[model samples]
Every structure is written in C-alpha cells, then in structure tokens.
Target chain A: MLEIKNLSARIGDKEILRGVTLSVPDGEIHAIMGPNGAGKSTLSYVLSGRDGYEVTGGEAIYNGQDILALTPEARAAAGIFLAFQYPVELPGVGNANFMRTALNAVKRARGEAELDAVAFLKLARAALKKLSMQDDMLKRNVNVGFSGGEKKRNEVLQMALLQPGLAILDETDSGLDIDALKIVAEGVNALRSETFSALVITHYQRLLDYIVPDKVHVLAAGKIVRSGGPELALELEARGYAGLEAA
Target chain B: MTALPTQRLESWRYTDLRALNAMSFAEAPAASLPDGLPDIGVPRLVFVNGRFDEAASSALPFARNFAAVDEVSDLPLARINAEHAHDGVTLEIPDGVDAGVVLLVSYANGGALHPRHRVSLGAGAALTLLEVVKGDGVYWHNPVTDIVLAQGASLAHYRLQDESQEAFHLATIRATVAADAAYESFTAVMGAKLSRAEFHVELTGAKAHTHLNAAQLLGGSQHGDFTSVVRHKAPDCSSRQTVKSVLCDSARGVFQGRIEVERVAQKTDGYQMSQALLLSPTAEMDIKPELQIYADDVKCSHGATIGALDEEQVFYLRSRGIPEDTARSMLIRAFLTEALEPVTHEGAHALFEAAIETWWARK
Candidate 1:
C-alpha cells in the first residue's frame, strides 16, 4: 500500500503541490486526472525525489517506510517506479547494457543474485518479445533516436522488467498512438498481481478506457478536489474539468 | 638545457610549466626491468629509463638502433628533446610490406628522459605501432617522434601515456603524408601530474588523410594538454580530429587544434571537434580551435562543447535504480565513445579500455 498525506512541495518560490492527500491500496490502480497546470507532474517528481523540488511538508509512506526520506534509487529499490512523460535520451548507452545495469543494481540492493550478461540478455529478450518489440531495440542506444511512440514503449519496457510494486505513470499516453497505447497498456496489465499497485497520472480519459482504474481523483490547485469510481473519468471527459476546482 | 616555453606563448597559454622549472633533475640511472608489462603476443621493444633493453625485446629485421640527427624546428619542446635525446626506436617498412603490429614500451624511474623515435613507410606499406609510456616517482619525459609515409602508405599509431602521477610528460610528433596515404592516431592520456602531447601533421599530396583522435581522463591536480596542427598542403587532402576530456577534482584539460589549408589545397575536407566533461566544481577545461583556409573551394568546420553532466540524465538513471557513481561513469563512457571509435586494433582497444577502467577505479 502507498499513502501520501498532505504532500506540499514547491519549485524555487512557487508552490506546486499544496496539501495533497491520496492513497492506493495493494492490488489496485488509481488514476489521477487533472487539467493543465494542476501539479500532476510535480507530484510524480516529488515522489521520486528529483532535484530542485523542495518538499515543505508531508510524507509518502510505501509499505510502511517514509519514502520521502529516500533517494531516487533508494525509492526504486523499495519497489517504486515512475514512468517518465518524457523518456530521457542517453546517447551511446546501449539499451541492453542500461537495463542490465539497472536490473542488477536493484537486485543487489534487494540481496538477490545479480544477473550475468547472458542471463540478463535472455531475460531482456523475453520481455521484448512479450512487448512485441524487435530485437534491434535492445541493440540501439537508450532512446537516443527513438520516435515519440517508441520512447513511451521503452518506458513500459523498463516497467515490465523492473516489476515495481507501485508504478507511477506520468502522462505516458500523451504522444503515443492507439497501437502503441495498447501495447503499453498490455505491458502494465501483464504485471497486475496481488502485490502490485499503480498511480496512473494522465490528462486524458481515453487511456483510462483501456487500463481502467479502481478510483479516479481530480487534482486541481495542488489538491485532490473530488474522488469517485472509474465512471467519474468518463463523466469528467464529457463535462471537462471546468468546475471541479471550485467543487 | 633549453628553456621551457612559458604561458605567454599562444600555444602554451592554458598550460603552466613553472613547477617543472623549480625541480632539478639528474640523469636517469640504469634501472631494472619493471614487472607486469602488457603482453599482446606481438614483437615488442622495451626501453628502461632512456636506453633500449635488447634482452627483453624481440629481434625484428626492420628495427635498428636510434641515431640522433640535427633537425631544425621552432617548437621549444621539440628543440629541448633534440638536445638531450639518446636511445629510441627507428622503424622502416619496405614497399608493399604489411609490418603487422609492433609494441614500443618506455619505462622511466625518476630522471629527465628524452627519446627520439623515427618511422618511415615506403609506398603501399602498412604498419600498426602501439606505444606505451609509463614510469614511477618524479621525472621528466620529453620524447619527439618523426614519421614519414610515402605514396599509398598507411600507419595506425596508438599511444597510451600512463606516466606516474608525479611525472611531467611532454611529447612532440611530426608526420608527413604523401598522396593516397593515411596517418591515423589515437592517444589516451590517463596519467601524469602535468603532460602535453603536441602533434604536427602535414598532408603534402592529393587525397592524403589523417585522423588525430584522443581522450584525456584526469583527476586530482593533474593537467593534460593535447595540441595538434594539421596542414593541408595539397588539393583533395582531408583531416579529422576529435578530442575528448574528462576532468575530476581540481584537474585541468586543454585542447588546441589548428587546421591550415594552403592556396592550392582546394577540396580540402577538414573537421575538428573538442569536447570536455568537468565532473567537479573546481575542474576546468580550455579549448582553442583555429582554422586558416587559403583555398577558395574547401569544406572545413570546427566545433567545441564544454559542460557538466546533465542533471536530467543523471536523474533518469538514478530513478532506474542505478547508483549515482555508476550512472556518472556510464554517461562519461558514452561521451568518450565517439573519440574512441577510431581505435580499430583489437588488442590496443582492449588495452585502452582497461586503462580507462583503472583510472576510474583509482578515483
């Protein structure tokens, strides 16, 4: 389970997340739908401990530990994964090597046996096959020359391989087409289990249609204004987030 | 002893040699052979201090004793080398002969050492020469190498400057390439407290080519400089230079690249790029790229980028569970990929890679 209590953060002087509280229990996926400038991305960055973000107050507890006190890599080892809205490009870093390094790091932190080159390649090839991605995808640099959809798919590929307990998807459906969207959604669906939970942050409701969430929350002015079932997303899509902030 | 050039000179602006001037050095004593020398299963010539060690070397037909000759040059370092140079390698390849790979190993232990090496390749000849310089304790290593490539000849020169952390290494190389010949070289600067490798290459015939690529990995208070002057003296000649520097702690890196195209050297294709990555707040890098084009129709360009590692890239790697140090290393190795791409010799490439890894481990 993940518990975020009154999370307030700021960038420099401007406050972004102001007294935000939310919760996602085990075996559940919650979607946070919000309008522009609603502090959705800031929430994800704060949870992941990115630099330049000052967390004034509040704590995020994941499975019993205050994750807000951990480093980004530490949070990742604690089973928290944030699928970036814009996957960073790493020139000259081969995808296979990157994934293997990341996987081994996480494994080492968890006191698990690290995978060798051959074992890691075998595992990565299996994940690629499941995602319907070509073998050449592993041979290229990490998102160096990838297309918009390919970058998103690469994020999902990472998510599948890492198998985090609480995966945060931050606007991952923005630049993806329908075909790529289904592939990404399937990658998430394949990892659904009793020990898995996800916080899907998106601005659109179309993605919610494929990967239906257990709960929908409207975040505006850095706070959760309304909360409801999956149908609330469809209603918001019809009515738009016009008066949700006032609610 | 010749006076060392000061910072007032244009080429020596970023590098200061006053520390070297303060120390008085004696002649190198005859030292025993150093252990753990790299062996790649090839003919090798080993030099201790400044003299050749024939017992530890393989006898090749083309290898001969070093004989110093009077050569005039305006470069102050080359002049200093010409004054005190003694034993070195002299390799001469005959026409159409593939001389394969040869190793030149120089080990110094506290002294002022100058070794002058000369290499000449006949027409259609090919040779791959790998030079490794290393030492222990405080010393001065000033070596000058002269290379001449005839028509259709090619020479792949790979150098690894792994001097001791308290040593001063100043090397000068001059090469002249004839028509249809190529002079390709790569230098890995991973040691020395203060070091500089200056190269002067001239393409004197049509379609002559040269690639001068290097990578400098410096830490602590070390200083490394890579300066090159490529003169295109004939039409249809080309030159390429890519130098990469990674500085950490209070280390400093410098790259001075100059490309000169003569009036008759039309269709000259010259390109130069210098990039540096400073890993600490105190580390510094200085780059000077000069182009003198007298030809009306030629393609020449130069670019430089010096900056710290990207924070966003760092965050991305960290979020994926990679530790901060490993993440930085991966990014740095990525930055050096382009500069190391030209090292096609398998054994040499492996050796350079191992040296880079050792440098990182030491940090």
Candidate 2:
C-alpha cells in the first residue's frame, strides 16, 4: 500500500502540491483526473524524488517506509516507478543494454541474482513478444529516433520489465494513438496482481475505459477536491473540470 | 633548439608549457620494461626510456634501422624532436604489400625522452600502425612522427597515450597523402598530467582523404590538448575530424581544428566537430574551429558543444533504478561513441576501450 499524507511541495517559490492527501491500497488501481495546471506531474515528480522540487511538509510512506526521504534510485528499488510523460533520448545507449543495467541494478538492490546477457536477452525477447514490439526495438538506441507513440510504448516496455509494485503514470496517454494505447494498457493489465497498484494520471476518460480504476479523484489546484468510485471519471469527463476547483 | 612555444601564440593559447619549461629534465636512464604490457599478438617494437629494445621487439623485414631525421620545420616542438631524438621506428612498406599490423610501444620511467618515427607506404600499399605510450613518475615525452602515403595507399594509425599522472607528453604527427590515398587515425588521451597531440595532414592529390578522430578522458589536474590542421591542396580531396573530451575534477581539455582549402581544391569536403562533457564544476574545455577556404566550390563545416551532463537525462536514468555513478558513466560512454566509431581495428579498439574503462574507474 502507498500512503501520501498532506503532500505539499513547491518549485522554487511557487507552491504546486498544497496539502494533497491520497492513498492507494494493495491490488487496486486509482485514477487521478485533473485539468491543466492541476499539479499532476508535480505530484509524480515529488513521489519519485526528482531534483528541484522542495517537499515542504509531507510524508510519502510506501509499504511502511517514509519514501519521501529516499533518492530516486532508492525509491525505484523500493518498488516505485514513474512512467515519464516525455521519455529522455539517450543517443548512444542501446535499449537492451539500458534495460539490462536497470534490471540488474534493481535486482542487486533486492538481493536477487543479476541476469547475465543471455538470460536478460531471453527475458527481454519474451517481453517484446508479449508487447508485440519487433526485435529491432532492442537493437536501436534508447528513444534516439523513436516516434511519439514508440516513446510511450517504450515506457510501457520498461514498466513491464521492472515490475514495480506502485507505478505512477504521469500523462502517458497524451501523445499515444489508439493502437499504441491498447498496447500500453495491455502491458499494465498483464502485470495486474494482488501486490500491484498503480496511480494513473490522465486528463481524458478514454484511457479509463480500457483499464478501469477502482477509485477516481479530481485533483484541482494541488488538492484532491472530489473522490468517488470509477464513475467519477466519466462524470467529470461529461461535465468538464469547470467549477470543480470551487467544490 | 628553438624555444618552447608560449601562450602568446594563438595556437598555444589554451595549453601552457611554462610548467614544463620550469622543470629541468636529465637524460632518461635505461630502465627495465614494466610488467603487464599489452600483447596484441602482432609484430611489436618496444622502446624503454628513449632507447629501442631489440630483444623485446620482433624482427621484420620492413622494420629498418633508425635513420637520422634531417627535416626542418618552423614548429618549435618538431625542431626540438629532430635535435634530441636518437632511436625510433623507420617503417617502409613496398608497393601493393599489406603490412597487416605493427605495434609500437614506448615506456618511460623519468626524465626527457624524444623518439622520431618515420613511415612511408608505396603505391596501393596498406598498413595498420598501433602506438602505445606510457610512463611512470615525472618525465617529458616529446615524439614526432612523419608519414607519407603514395598513390592509392591507405594507412590506419591508432594511438593510446596513457602516460603517468605526473608526466608531460607532447607529440607531433605530420602526414602527406598522394592521389587516391587515405590516412585515417584515432587517438585516445587518457593519461598524463599535461599532454598535447598536434597533427598536420595535407592532401596533395585528387581524391585523397583523411580522418583525424580522438577522445580525451582527463581527471584530477590533467590537461589534454588535441590540435589538428588539415590542408586540402587538390580538387576532390576530403577531411573529417571528430574530437570528444570528458573532463572531471579540475581537468582541462582543448581542441583546435583548422581546415585549409587551396584555390585549386574545388569540391573539397571538410568537416570537424568537437564536443566536451564537463563532469565537475571546476572542469573546463576550450574549442576553436577554423576554416580557411580559397576554393570557390567547396564544402566545409564545423560544430562544437560543451556542457555539463543533462540533469533530465540523469533523472531519467536514476528513476529507472540505475545508480547515479553508473548513470553518469553510461551517458559519458554514449557521448564518446561517435568519436570512437572510426577505430575499426579490433585489438586497438578493445585496448582503447579498456583504457577508457580504467580512467572511469579511477575517477
């Protein structure tokens, strides 16, 4: 389970996340739907411990540990993953090498045996097949010349391989098309288990139709204004985020 | 001998030799060969201090005796090299002969050492020369190499300058390519407290080509300089230069590349790029790219980029569970991929890669 209590953070002088409180239990996927400038991305960045964000007053506890004090890599090793909205382009880093290195690092931190080249390739090939991605995807540099949809799918690919317990997807469906969206959704669905929980942050309700969430919250102006069952997302989509900040 | 060039000269602006001039170096004493020398399974010539070691070298027909260097040049370093250089390689390849590989190893313990090497390839000849320079303690290594390639000849020169942290290495390389000839070279600068490798290449005939690529990995207080001048004097000639530097601690890196196209050198294709990655707040890089084109129809371009590692890229890697140090290394190796792409020789590539790995580990 992941617990975020009174999560107030800022960038420089402007406060972004102001007294935000939310929780996602085990075996559940929650959707955080919000309008523009609602501090959705800031929430994900703060949870992952990215630089430049100052967490003024809050404690993010994941599986009984105060993860707000951990480094980004430490949080990742503690089973926290944040799917970036914009995947970084690594010009000369091969995708296979990157994934293998990341996987081995996580494994090493968890006291698990690190995978060799052969074993890692076998696992990667299997992952690619399941995602319907071609083998050449592994041979190219990491997102060097990838298309918009391809970059999103690559993020899902990383999510599938890493298998984090709590994934915070920050606007991953923005630039993705329908076909790529299904592939990404399937990648998340395949990892559904009792120990797996996800915080899917998106603006449109179309993605929620595929991977239905157990709870939906409206985050407006850095605070959760309304919370309800999965139908809350469809209601907000129909009524629009207008006047919700006043609620 | 001419005096050492000072910072007042435009070409020596970034690299200062006052420290070297202040130190008084005695003649290098004969020292035993160091253990754990790289054996690339080829014909090798070993030089300890400033003297050639015949016992440790393989006997080859083309490996002739060291001849006196009588060539005079305006460069002070070259003039100094010609004056004091006693023993060096004189390799001469016959026409159409493929001299597979030759390894030249230079090891210095201390003091001043200068070795002048000369190589000439006949028409349609091919040769791959790998030179490794290393030393210990404080010393001065100033070597000059002269290469001549006849018509249709090709020479691939690879150098690894792994000197000691307290050593000074200054090398000058001059090459002349005839019609249909190619001179390709790559150097990795991973050692030495202060080092500079200056290259002068001239394409004197039609269709002659050259590629001068290098990578400098410096840490601590080390300073590395790679300066090159490619002169295209004939039509249809081409030259390419890609230099990359990774600086850490208070290290400094410099790249000075100049491309000159003569009036008759129409259709000349020249390109140069210099990039640097500064890993610390104190590390510095200087890049100067110049193009002097007298030809009416020619293509010449140069680019340079110097900056710290991208924080967004670092965060992306760290968010994926890669440790900070490993993430930085991965990005740095990526930065060097383009500069190292031209090193096709398998053994030499591996050796350079190992040297880069060692430099990273020490940093």
Candidate 3:
C-alpha cells in the first residue's frame, strides 16, 4: 500500500534520510530500527508534509498515488496518519472537539455523512473505553498536562478514530513504560486487517516483541542497510548498532 | 472630546482624542431602532439624545428625574452629564429581593448625548443589568453609570457598547462593593470610530469580591480604549481583571489598568492581565498594567502580552484537516473564551459570542 524509492531529505545545511528506500505492502507492518539521528523522525515528517523539511530527492507513493505532492491536510484526507513522536499541547482546544472536527473533515472529503455532536460523542466514548482512557479526558485541552504515556495513548486514540490506510508511528515507543507499551501495541494490534498497514519506527527490539512485525529493516547512516524477517530484530538486539556497524 | 492629552500625560499618552475634532455632528432624528436588548423580561429604559422618551420606555419604580450634579464628577464629559442629563434612571433593588433584569438603552441621535444611571442594591439583594449603547450618524455618546452593592448583595452587569461607525463613545463607571458583596461586569466592544470606556471599582468592606472582564474586536481604522482602576480597600478582598483585544487592518487598541491595595487591605489578592492579538502588521496595541500595593501581606501580579497568531498552533489545527482560515478563527474564538467565560447571563453570553464570530467572519 505504500512505497518509497531513493528518498532523500534535509533540513537547512545538514542532510538526513540520504537515498533511503523501503516498502510496506498492504496488510503488513514493517519495522525500521535505527540509532539516534538516523533520520527516522525525518522520514515521518516528510511523509506527513511538515514544513522546513526540504525533500532533496526521492518519491513516496501511497495507494498508487503520489503522496509527496499533497498538503499535510490533503494527505490526511487521503488516509495517511502520522502519530507524532511528541504530540503538541493545544491550549483551550478540547480533545473531543479536535477529534470530531478531524473525523468530520476527513468524512466530508470522502463524501460521507458527518456525525453530529451526539453521534460523535458516542463513537468517541466507545473508542476511549477501548483504549482504557477515562471519559473526562475529552473535556480537557488537547495533550496539555498529559503524562508521556497518556500522550502516546492519545495518538493511538487518534489513529483508531481516523482509521487511515497507512500510519507512520514515529518513535511512539520511546517514552512509554511497559504497560503503556502493551496498551499501545494492543491498540495497533486491534486494527490488524487485510487493508490496514503501518510503519513501526523504533530503535529497540522490545516493542517488536509485542507488535511483531512482518518485516524488519535496519536503518543506519540514513539508508536501509538490511531487510529480513522478524528474527532480524532479535539479532540486532543481541548485537547493538555499533557491533553491526563494525561488521 | 476635542482635547488630546500629550505624551507627557501618563494615562492618555497614546490615545489622541483630538482626532475626533474634525468630524461634524448633527441632530439625529428619531428613527426606527434596532432590537439591541435581550429578551429576558428586562424593564427597558430608552433615552434619545440624553432625553428620556416616555413613548419608548416602560416605567420602573426607580425611574425618576435627574438629581443635582455629583461632586465626584471629574472630567468634562461627566460634568456635561451632571449639568445637562435629563430623564436619568435610578434603579433601587429593595432588601432581599431578586430583581430579575433591568435594560438600559442610550442612543446618540446624531448629536451630543449624556445619559446618567445610578444603581443601588440593598442588603441581600441580587440583580442582573444589561446596558447597551448604539446610534446612527455622527454623534457623541457620553454615559456615566454609578453602582453601589450593599452588604451581602450581588450584581451581574453586561455592557455592550456598539456605537455606529461615525460615532464617538465615552463611558465612565464607578462602583463600590460592601462587605461580602460580589460585583461582576463584562464589556464587549465592536463599534465606534473613537471610543473610551473607563471603570473605577472599589472593594470597600471585608470579604468583598470584584471581577472586570472585557473583549474588544475591531478592524479598519477604528480605535478603542479600556481604562480601569480597581482599589482593594478592605481586608480579604479579591479582584481580577482580564482584557482581550483583537485588532486587524490599521485598527489600534489600548488597555490601561491600575490595581491598588491599600495599607489596611491585608490578605488582598489581585490579578490583572491584558492580551492583544494583532492580525495585521500595521495593527497596533498599547498595554499598561500596573500594581500598587501598600499592604505588606498582599499578593498582586500583572501581565501584558502582545502577539500575532501562534504559527505552531495554527499548523497544529491545520494538520487536523481544518482549513487554514477556519483554524485561525477557532483559535481566535478560543482566545476570547477566557474573557467571555465570566459572563453570567446566558442570553448576553450567546449574543456577544455571536458578535465575535461575526466580527471575525466579516474580516
């Protein structure tokens, strides 16, 4: 469902994601493991069309359509979701209002009937229950005063609500504890289907144990150095990135 | 209205009232009036060019002829109201009575108008007051309101000043709260070419509370000023003042707020904040928030912020699929919510909320 070829990007004078390429077919989850500054987050930002990320070269395609040419919002309407590594704090904007507006916007773009306040609240409450979040969370400002784990879970909540065709998880497991990791993994695991696909980006193999990936790609020096089955993650865990770099 | 204070004057330095000297004024004939008052069975008092029209007003028990001039009148406009204001209203709420609502409407019919209103609430009384000022054509609207809240009494006042585009509006209010009394007021300004609203509030007795909240939205060449002085004179009294201004195009706004805690006013808590959002590069705002505390055991703070739209917040909303314009509007509306939240009347809140949206949409 998603493909990238010769993807190269940079910020200002420094180059990141130099000639990186990978593909995640429909119904499959691909894991990208890299050390700090391995252009992992840059890849997510580029896919989501974040500003200041100059796309030097390469092409990213989603569902046989060019994803690089669309605006961030348009990409969202086309079923592309990016769970930001650090969710921004939106003061005075309620979480429930944000989600409902987002859901309605995407629905309108897809030519579907939009949900009113009553229907929207019902759907949101059910989603919150599934995610083990309290109902009062909807009343608070978006991500303000939320714990690190709660922020990640909120992102997962958004993914569940948006139900995008392709989701880019950018370091979502970094700050989460063990329980939070499982809840996040369960939330993603629950969405496993023939049509749903995700790119699990992380530096450790611990997350792989929970949301076992169909494919593993070791990203180093801004490129995919190796691609293998799930066992590849375990091998990398035994030998750190430094050991692999030496070899 | 013609004299502009030079920069040497502290309070009126940036606001040049003399700019209004060039506009010609005319006597606005009594014409059709708009539905400016809310429908809450509020006894209505209508004034045209400072004269009460018996045909257009419904009498309340306190409606009476103007008394002699007040010795406290300081400015030329206040003195003008004291000398010329006719058919003024004096609303007195009896002890322990819940006087529902009282509506005061002042229309500057293309000429100089001075409408004086006095409101007094007896012990244990409660009331909600709506005061609206508007007019058509070139006119001068000078209104003075004095309020006294007795012990344990409470009052909620909503002031909507939306004069015509060619109109000049200057309003002054003085209020005093007795022991354990509560005074709350919210003002929303959307009209007038040159307008100034001044408030002087005093917490006179122990355990008193006062809150003054305002939101001013303007575009074009319009100018607005919200100046207020709040004094905490009694022990354990608290005061809060919040002002939000949105200026677009070449519009200019000003906020001058002074909070004072006297020596005997121990345990006083006072807060003042003024924030302005400039939508255009040329749009300007001048804010001066001051705190004077002679009391040793008191807590008082003041803050002022002048900024444009937060780009990160804008992008955050845009990424959620809300259009760029819609996202900006939402953020602007949210910014005004803090000032509007303290407004107690349901009808008045909805009305002013709609006016804010309409102002932004009009831009």
Candidate 4:
C-alpha cells in the first residue's frame, strides 16, 4: 500500500535519512527498529510530509500515488496518520471539537457522510468505551493535563475515529508501562484488517510481543539494512544492533 | 495644580502625545444610533456624544440619576473628561433583584464624548451590564464609570469597544467592593486607531472577590491598551486578572497591571497573567506587571508571555487534515478563550465570545 525508494532527507546542514528504500504491502503490518540515530522518526516524518525536512532525493508513493508531493493535510486525507512521539497539548481546544473536525475532514475527503454533533457523540462514545475512557475526556482540552498513556490513547482514539488506511506510530511504546502497552497494543490490534496497515516504529522488542508484525526491518543511518520475519526483533533484542552492524 | 497625564508620564510611554496635542477635540454632535444591536430583550440606554436621548431610551423602571461630571482622575484623558463631560447614566439595582441585561450604547463622530456613569448594587443584588462604544469618523470617546457593590452583591460588566478605525477611544472604570461582593469584568478591545481602557478596582471589605478578564484583538496599524490597578485593603480578599491579546500586521498592544495589598489585607490572594500572540513580525506588544504588598502574609504573583503562533502545534493540526487557516483560528480562539473562561453571565459571555469570533473572522 505504501512505497518509498531512494529516500534522502535533511534538516538544515545535517542529513538524517540517506538513500532509504522500503515498502509495505496491503494487509501487512511492518515494524521499523534501529539505534538512536537510525532515522526511525525521520522516516515517519518524511512519509507524513512535515515541513522543514528537505527531501533531498526521494519519492514516497502511497496507494500508487506520490505522497511526498502532497501537502500534510492531503496526505492525511489520503489515509495517512502519524502518531507523534509527543502529542501537543492544546490548552483551550476541546477534545470533542478536535476529533469532530478531524473525523469530518477525513470523512468528507473520502466521500463519506459526515456526522453531526449528536451522531458524532454516539460514535465517539462507542470508541471511548472501547478504550475504557470516560465521557468527560471529550469535554477537556486536547492532551492538556492528560497522562502519557492517556495522550497515547487519545492518539489511538483519533486514529480509530478517522480510520486511516495507513498509520505511522513513531515511538508510541517508549514510555508505556505493561498495562498501557497492553491497552495500546489492543487498540492497534483492534484496528487490524485487510484494508488497514501500520508502520510500527520502536526501539525494543517489547511491543512486538503484543502486536505481532508480519515483517521487521532494521534501519541504520537512514537505510534499511536488513529485512526479516518477527524473529529478527527477538534476535536484535538478544544481540543488539552491533550484531547486525557486524553482519 | 494637578498635572494632566501626558507622554512625559511613565504610564503613557509608548503612545504618542503629539497626536493628541493636534486634534481640536471639540464636543462632537449627537450622531444617530447604528442599524443593528444585539437583541437581548432588555432595557436599552442609547447615548449620542455622551448625551442621553430620553426619547430614544426606554423608560427607566428602576432608579437612576444624572449629575455633572466632577470626580477627577490623574490620567490626562480623565482630566479632559472631567473638564468637559456631556451627560451621565446611573442605574442603581435594589436588594435581591437580578437585573437582566442592561444595554448601554454610545455613538460619536469627529468629537470628544465623555460619558460618566455609576452602578451601585444593593446587598445580595446581581446585574449584568453591557456597555458598547461604537461610532464613525475621527472622534475621541472618553468614558468614566463608577461601580459600587454592597455586601454580598455581584456584578458582571461586559465592555465592548468597536470604534471607527480613524477614531480615538480612552475609557476608565473605578470600582469599590463591599464584604463578600463579587465583581467580574470582561472587556473585548477590537477597534479604534488609538484606544486605552483603564480599570482601577479596590477591595474595600473582607472576603470580596474580583476578576478582571480582558481580550484585545488588533490588526493593521491599530493600537490597543489595557491598564489596570487592583488594590486590596481588606483581609482575605482575592483578585484575578487575565489579559490576552492578538496583534497582526503592525498592530501594537499594551498591558499594564498592578496589584497592591495593604497591611490589613492579610491572606490576600492575587494572581495576574498577561499573554500576547503576535501574528506578524512587525506586531508589537508591551506588558508591565507590578505587585505592591505591605502584608507579608499575602500571596500575590504576576506573569507575562509574548510569542508567535507555535509552529509545532500548527504542524500537528495540519497533519490531522485541518487547513492552515482553520488551525490558526483554533489556536487563536483557544488563546483568547483561556482568558475569557472566567466570564460567567451567559449573555455577556456570549457577547464577548461573539466579538472575538467577529474579530477572528475579519482578521
């Protein structure tokens, strides 16, 4: 569903992603793991079309079209969702308003019927119930005073509400504890389907144990050095990136 | 001889004095009212050039008095008003009565209109006052309002200033509060070439509470200023001041707030915060906060923040499929709402929020 070839990105004077090429087929979930400077987050941002990142030499194709040429909102409407490493806290913007705007926008772009307040509340309450969160969360400001797990769950709630075709979760598992990790994994797991695909970005194999992936790729200094089955995550956790670098 | 405030004074640092020296500032004519005003089904007091029109205004069912403007202020514009004020409107609320919405409108053109007014709340009385200043041409609108709240009385004052782009506006409000009285004021500054709204509040009785919430939205070369002074003379009184401004183009915004606690005002809790959002590189904001405390046991603090639209938040919103303009509007509204949240009266809150929405739409 998504294709990237010869992706090179740079921010200012430093080059982050250099000649990285990767792809994920429809109905398959993939994982990207690497060291600190492995350009894991850069790959996600490059795919999501964030500003200030100069794509020096790369073309990202999503659903057979060049996604890099599209604006960030266009990419999102085209079914690309990026769960940021750190969610922003909008002080006075209510969660319900943000979710409604986002959901209606995506739905409108996809030629689907938009939901009004009442209809939107019903749908949102269902999703909140699935996440075991209260209805009061919708009244509060977006991510304002929310715990780390709650913020991550809010991101997932957004993803579930928007129902994007492709999701890039960057470092979503970094700060989650066991219970949070289980809920987060369950949230992603619940969305698994033939039409949906996710690019799970993480540093450890802990998340892989819950939300098993079809394929795992080792990203080093911006390039995909190795591609293997789920066992690659366990192997990397055991021997570290040094084992892969030596190979 | 008491000296009128001028550019030489520290309080009028950024505003120019030469401009005021040039204007004739003659008493303006009684121009007609505007075509549209909010339909809140309340008593309306309409004024033209500071003169009350008995034929146009509704019959006064309650109590009212019109006297010569006499009280003088150290501010230059207040002095000007004292020297030449046209008429005044005083609405005194009786005990335990909840006066709905009182709409006060002032219209002017090519002149200085000084309207002095007073609002005295009886014990346990409540009121919501909507004061609107709007007009055209090159006029100077100077208004003074005195508010006194009796024991356990409460008042919600909403001030909406939408003057001509070529006009000048200067207004001052001095208020006193009794024991357990609640005073909440919200001002939305949207128009005027040069405008200043000064609020001086004194908590005279113990356990009184006061909230001064204001929002200023200016674009182009417009200038808006909100200067306030809050004094606590009684014990256990609390005061909160939140002022937010959004300046675009070369618009300039100024916020000066001061809080003073006397020795008898122990356990006084005062908090003041001023924030500005500059949408353009040339937009300027000057914020000054002061706290004077003779009570060692009092708790008082003030803070100020000035910044441009956060790029990260913008990007995050856009990444979620919201357009840039919508994202900007959301952030600006959020910024303003943070300061406007304290407005309790539904009518005044909606009016203030509507003014903000209109400013956002125009900008």
| DockQ-based class of model 4 | medium
User: TM-score of every model?
Assistant: 0.97, 0.98, 0.92, 0.95
lDDT of 1 by residue, B147-238 (tens): 99999999999999999999999999999999999999999998899999999999999999999999999999999999999999999999
Q: Which of the numbered candidates is closest to the native, going by highest DockQ? A: 2
Model 1 per-residue lDDT tens digits across residues A1-247: 9999999999999999999999999999999999999999999999998999999999899999999999999999999999999999999999999999999999999999999999988988899999999989999999989999999999999999999999999998998999999999999889899999999999999999889899999999999999999999999999999988889
Candidate 3: give the clashing pairs.
Answer: B28-B109
For model 2, how does the per-residue alpha-carbon lDDT over A64-126 read when each residue is reduced to its tens digit? 999999999999999999999999999999999999999999999999999999999999999
Candidate 1: CAPRI quality band: high
Question: lDDT per model, in order?
Answer: 0.93, 0.93, 0.84, 0.87
The residue pairs in collision within model 4 are none
Q: Estimate the overall C-alpha local distance difference test score of candidate 4.
A: 0.87
Q: Using alpha carbons, what is the TM-score of model 1?
A: 0.97
DockQ, per-model, please?
0.87, 0.89, 0.54, 0.76
lDDT tens digits, residue span B298-358, model 4? 8898999999989889888888988778789989989988677667667767777777778
TM-score of chain B of each: 0.98, 0.98, 0.92, 0.95
* Best prediction by TM-score: 2
Q: Place model 2 in a CAPRI quality band.
A: high
TM-score of chain A of each: 0.99, 0.99, 0.98, 0.98
- In model 1, the runs with Cα more than 4 Å from the true position are B24-26
lDDT of 2 at A59: 85
Q: What is the DockQ of candidate 2?
A: 0.89
**Fnat per predicted structure, each in turn:** 0.84, 0.85, 0.42, 0.76
